[model samples]
Target chain A: MKRWIPFILTLALLVPIGAEAAIVVVVNNANPTEKMSERELIDMYMGRNLYFANGQLALRLDHSPKSSVRRDFYRQLVGKTVAQVNAYWARLLFTGTAAPPHVIPDKSEVIEAVKKNVNAIGYIDEADLVEDLKVVGRID
Target chain B: MFSSIHTPLRWLICGSCLVLMAWFISPGLVNAQVINDNDFKVSGFLTLGATRGGDEFLGFRRFVSQEGVFEDEWSYKTDSVIGVQFDKKFTSNWAATVQLVGRERIKNSFKESIDWAFLKYRINPNLTARAGRIGMSIYMLSDYRNVGFAYLWARPPTDFYSLIAFDYYDGADIVFNAPLGSGTFKAKFLVGSSENKFRFNDSAAEFKLNNMFGASLLWENQTWRFRYGFLSFDFDDSINQVLGTDLVADAFELADAFGWDGADNTADDIRAEGESALYHALGFVYEKLPWTIQGEISYLDTDYDVIKSNITRYISVGYIFDEITVYGMLGKGSQTSSRTKLPDLPDSLSSIPLAVQLRDGAQLLYNASYADQESIAAGARWDLRYDIALKMQLDHIRVEENGTVYWASDTLPDKDRAINIVSINLNYIF
Candidate 1:
């Protein structure tokens, strides 16, 4: 029984960490753009850039604020916690200078939204990726 | 008698109506439209704050006084505010926005004021233009000054912000954004005019600035941002009437006795007229995970002698821990007048009794420009919920030379003194 304690504790901690590693940024399979650098991603997400490299108006998607995947994605992409990003967006949103991305309920909805729109971009767990969505970038 | 209570109560009723309207529409509106795909979006923010201080601060009467004595009390009308914003996108290239904000003020009733009403047209992927009432970009946070939840401080430093009496201008602006190196560079050019009413004591004065123009440049990356701004305007204060004051009459009487042009000595002469004033500001922000640092320096100079030239600067540093952020700020400011002694009086009339009174009054006016202040503040912000934050702050301010910058009752002394203020606020957004 004592030997089982360590195994259970290790599994409990590693499970969440392993789950977090599966997050990836996804785009429509038809998007001519193959990949994007971290700088471009940050600029697009922060509202500094409104268009993709190909000059198409970019439509960014965000998961629900309560989702753990949404929190992890921002932390990995911009080194900002969920609260910090929210505060940052609040400033821009209230000023009419910029607007945050449209929020969908879960990873599957995000995938569906991205699949339907060529200019759309979203992030989801690696396990949620389907055939219609292309993995443009992976969150480390 | 009815003015004070009526304004606040009316504001409360208006606020209730807005709350009810938003509550009734949110569920249906949100479900039917995705934010990015929708043609219309509605959003709002509110901040409820209470401030207490050892002495009168920031034009707010902090205490009651009898005749020439002051007593300590709490003032709650200093920083409470509510605002709502609406945006409607007509097409991919065109959009319209309006924001209304309500707050307590000494002169205007608590009616919601239109902070911004503008139409935006996207010229290209890299260029855009907005026309209507837009906020002046003189300071780093000027775009979001009233959005308390966006910043780490409970309030911006009063000494610096109080210098500018106007916030919005009726004009147009164009913004250009480009990728520079590994960062983004943005340039904005704006031209417009503004008219504002400012209150001192119980009297309000109207100030107009015409042909107002400014430009701002910003460079930012993931961890750092740098901003520089310059603005110049043709100022006109000709219609400023000093209500409930006899100073103007006294000055005229003294001027007549000297057989000199009293017009030059009258209060009207002090009006800014078509004079020009220039303002320049530089600011930077650096943030990396748990640590953040930001600072700004600004200077203002006017062609008129009566208006004092001033310089102000502040630096703030903070550390973030999960949902809580703690910050400290240090600031200093000074104002100096150009005219040391009123245009040298004629030697022939120097001996007149009126000459002495005139000289004293002029001296009083010159002395009023003397201000040297320093302040230190510490504050903490706690994210209480998804969209709500609670903040508390304490400030220690020292008036090193004169207290002309701050609002104080007649009974309060104007000499060097230190004041302590405590403030708490709840900020939220929807």
Candidate 2:
């Protein structure tokens, strides 16, 4: 009961009430990588580990500021808010410990970038999928 | 001879030239972190803050190395700072990065402002090596301590972070990461030499750490992270340098005057030359959704008697409510009872000026480590935008007499007192 208080208050106190999309992780079709696991995606996205199962370097694409899909994606993936994710990256970024992922505000731009690079990994709303990309995993 | 490292104007010219070269090499430029299609990038962070309230004796200093001390006033000198970094990747396996920070520094020069300039060589997907002046990561937030946007609080808890300060070590390190169970295991071994220049009122002191060896181990999963670290270093010079007076000479002159010469824990134990010290720390963080909790405990062991051994620890808990985070923290720093004791001068000679000199000086030495204090803080952060945030914090600190380690005092009292401090910060990144 004590642990549930914060969770209950969060739902009751949150200010933004918008429709959430089912966020999906996608890769270039040219990539031979099979379905990625949650652990692998987390590692890649967070720069904890930069290699895929195929032993190839992985590049990640991120959503721009205030994107609803980005918020739901991090909350569903790591149980953290977008601000928390940014703070985590800031720890690594300013220190030159790791480089942040490239950001694309438009879904079309992300799709095109993914199609051009076999090492690229990105995510989007399942409803906005272009079908040319491979759906490796879902945030849920 | 060691003064050569203080040259900053030459470093500034070189830094400017290099930045210009990077700019021209990348004819096309995008936003921060992305410079055209080329592998060169630039990024920066800044914070302008207002801090007020504290005892006049307690100088508002963030760390020991900084020269500017906020003396119980509404001063911006203590919190306003800006930093810029340039990163150039030559190839898949080779890279170089340079970072420069501008703020109220020890010397207010480029040498003191340049935090990190290192060359990285990726050995494989799991292993990497870095040379040149590398950023030291003894604590969890040491890497990003300057980037206020990277943290939820207006500042890191003071009791723990302010205990000791060295920006980075001038040396090399190897970092390795591997999959261990459901989490990632990371390890680093580093060796280097570092220096800190501190100013207290009208006096200045220099502390140099030579022949330093350290190791850090970390393991983290989705919701839990743990870290253990160890560092050993030798003082480059007698810690009497901290007193800024010929304390060794004073100790010996008094020893000769008194008959208890060569006695244990007495004047004989005042040899503080080049003592080696060891530091160990353990920390952990648990974050899931709207809840976050983290804590760290560190111990410093030194054989030097006057400079007593020390320990510091803190724990913080925060709850996230969408764009705003409200957090509370508790932190403490104190001297351990593990030091050679100096018996009070015999009552017969207590009134003598020489005996008084030795006793008062020894007491001051002991009080230097006593900047002892226990503090509790509550703060709130509002993320106004993706790149900007506003934060305010209030700290109530109970100061113990003789702990000059954190405060500035002309004469330290043997009493304990309470003081409150408030800070407001606007943090941003680009």
Candidate 3:
């Protein structure tokens, strides 16, 4: 009875909040490269691996700070918390080491940042990719 | 010998002109995109911390002297520190930075200070040059000794960092960075000399101090980095010369009191002298995936006229999870010098046959040696919130040396052999 009650409650809670779901991923409309493996994509976004599949410098873009999309992006791609990422950068920056990639504020901001730069790539909700923005691949 | 005066006035004037040029050229000239938006501004950071040695002697050793004296009770104060760094980015190609640090009295009562300044001129996207006061890059973690956030713990291994206190020199560095297929490459070449005053020990008739000149090369690629450097210093005649004379006179007095055959003569002939130091250091770091490890080995060869050489090595390892990291470290070493005397002989017996002298002293006089000290530290870092972390560390240290004890009845109390320290800190960076 208790399990049934919790299951019913969960359904009740989720049914009304049928929020939009988005498959976020990066894409290149003009480049010859067609697809990226999950590892390659995660490497590019997490600031760990910087080179593209073709060995070219991969310029990356991001959702704005504190954005839900950004949080989801990292949770799905980096598998680490914001605090861990901050600590990672702390270790890197203070050691006279490398700095992380530049951060753009929002989906629109990222879309604009990536659109203007040829080597750029970033994530946004699947629904957000209109006719202008191309969909290279879906995450998961 | 320290009073070498140069054209300080000329340097100051040149600095003023550079500032004026920066102000006059609003940067719309080079990139045209950069403006005096005041949005582009400079920020700085500073920190101050102090510690009191425990009732039992605590803290850094008296390095100037080779002798170890345990203080019954001593309250120590250090500038601990206050510093300011001004960071300016004029264009995508030009950036300038200035750092000034004030240290507490290094000498008995005189303060010490160093001005660390740099002007970085970016050549292309992968290379740059920096000129000004630059500290040597010993370890990847050694360069930013002041920027506390670099490490997960309160401090990096103190044994290595503390041994060669001054790591920076005034010079120019050329740094290059490039990306390999899956990793990044970083290289730095630096050369410079130090213009500063440092104090080592408080006792000893043969104290040593010197001015240092050196160069270091560092290379880092993704998960691994290596550093190798050589440094040489010219030491001036020591303040111990007078102390050595006094010891000789005292020896003569003691020999007469002891009714020794050479009652009229003293062992002043055995007074050991001081010498300069030339040293080399090699360090390595590997951080791939969830594990990070760092190790450094250094060899310090003092021209102490006599005795065997001294070499020290330090190693540490760390592992990181989402927000927590645990680390362990081990450091053990010793310094050997003929000047070190055995402690057992009467204060008057300044010299004797080497074999007899070795037995008479309780690791005192020319047995002038530091206990082979060893320590094992384990610590964890917890990130409680954004920008702040709570850290707790425990360290157990062991010191091997000859010390004294008062006979209470017939029982022997274990003198100073083991020490335990626990520290908790909240660190934050903005």
Candidate 4:
């Protein structure tokens, strides 16, 4: 598992949220961020950066804990398994070091979560992407 | 490994502090988490472990506070534990966290389980400060050592991690984190007084650490993290079980005072108070897919004779294969400095019972504090499910002459022994 952590951190090499889930990272249209890199995406999702590229606070959102899309989203964005990511957060969370992103459920809820807050950023299936949500990055 | 404020009234005081901090942050630490989710959250982890083997009389120990490892018997006390955490994020910039762990750490009380209770205030995106009781962050894993599912080992290497039995400090610290190129750079500074523990059955054996100051720096990028930590404190311990309650220090002082034949007037060299010690460590972790490597080397330098100056180091390499991970580790700890000198008494004078005791006690104090030992281990971890893991390990250690102090035994061994320990553990998080 020690060795497994390295492959998980090489975020640039892999982008499959799952082997087949084509996902698109989305933010409220009100959010000025029009593009996102995996690095920037990882920074926000991993609690390293809480503000959007435009210097506005970002209310990061995620799928429910058990949601497969949520699992793949982290794998695609950071090359880490959901368990590894959870352990990482456990260290920070239990230590009062950082706050994890707010969690909403799967599907339209993930999209609705982004729409309700201008500072929100979330991921949804590319097919589920709606006009109300601005696509920042797409994971194949 | 933890000490909590005793008395029901104390909880009210702790609660009052909590309320005050919460009230203090409300007047617009506006960065409060702007989320709709419930602000209070709870989480926990558990580990069920048992170990068998090793010297029956010499007993294995993970912490100095532990009476002994289940010892040559399959006992769950060595690693079995459960910890629960509660967190309330008041705002984006303010929060409170408390963690309680249940284990066999002799305080045998609920208070001893309180490992962390602190108020966190984020000064900015790149800086944060915390107050109250917090874990001793002097080592790479000290922050989360109790969470078994977070790491790959059955337990931290004893030779290195167990050298200093301190658990947490009551004080404050400021942490700074910022992006450095493609990675992150973190710096921390802390100051506070730590705990003072009494042996389970012995009151004279008190361990007190005061006026502690510490700092650490870490640089991490994809696949690798490097860290260095430094801490110092004034230590005064009268552990009768090991060093005979300052007998060696007093013996030397008297011999030098009376100018014993071999005494070079160096009695004042070791004192009962004002003794200070410094600790420093360098550690690194690297991971790249199927393989990971981690290593750390730490040194404890002190003028005190009981602990003397000591150094410990370990390196672990692991490989993952599907749901299972296999790993091996090498570790060693040694006494680096000696603070005792034998008296040069004539054979005829040494025959006196008092003189014989002085020489033997001095010899015992000089050699008994040594933790010189080396160990090698192989282990396998199976993560058959998302939140659970099963681990099995076999450890072989060879103890050096007079190095039995690391064990739980009070009497020094007549001869060094080689021992083996077999362990199995089940771990989970929720």
* Per-model CA lDDT versus the true structure: 0.73, 0.76, 0.51, 0.74
Q: Give the poorly placed runs of model 3, Cα more than 4 Å off.
A: A1-85, A91-108, A112-140, B1-55, B58-84, B101-115, B180-182, B196-226, B232-278, B286-290, B305-309, B336-339, B342-371, B402-416
Show model 4 residue runs off by greater than 4 Å: A1-21, A54-57, A64-67, A103-105, B1-38, B196-204, B237-248, B251-259, B262-270, B338-345
lDDT of 4 by residue, B231-289 (tens): 99886444333335455556756665554754433334433457789999999988666
Query: What TM-score, to 2 decimals, does candidate 3 have?
Result: 0.63
Cα RMSD for candidates in order: 4.2, 7.3, 9.8, 8.5
Model 2 chain B: lowest-lDDT 10 consecutive positions: B27-36
**Deviation from native of the Cα of residue A79 in model 2, angstroms:** 1.4
Can you list each candidate's DockQ? 0.48, 0.30, 0.17, 0.17
The model with the greatest TM-score is 1
Alpha-carbon deviation at A118 in model 1, angstroms: 3.6
> Model 2: how far is B383 from its true place, Å?
1.1
**TM-score for each predicted model, relative to the true structure:** 0.88, 0.87, 0.63, 0.85
lDDT score for residue B308 of model 3: 31
Q: How close is candidate 4 to the true structure, as a TM-score?
A: 0.85
Per residue, candidate 2 scores C-alpha lDDT tens digits across B250-336 of 565556567544433444445566689998888999988688899999898987666667888999999989899899999998878
B280-314 in candidate 1: lDDT tens per residue? 98999998899888899998887565556788889
CAPRI band for model 1: acceptable
| 1 versus 4: better lDDT goes to | 4
- TM-score of the A chain in model 3: 0.74
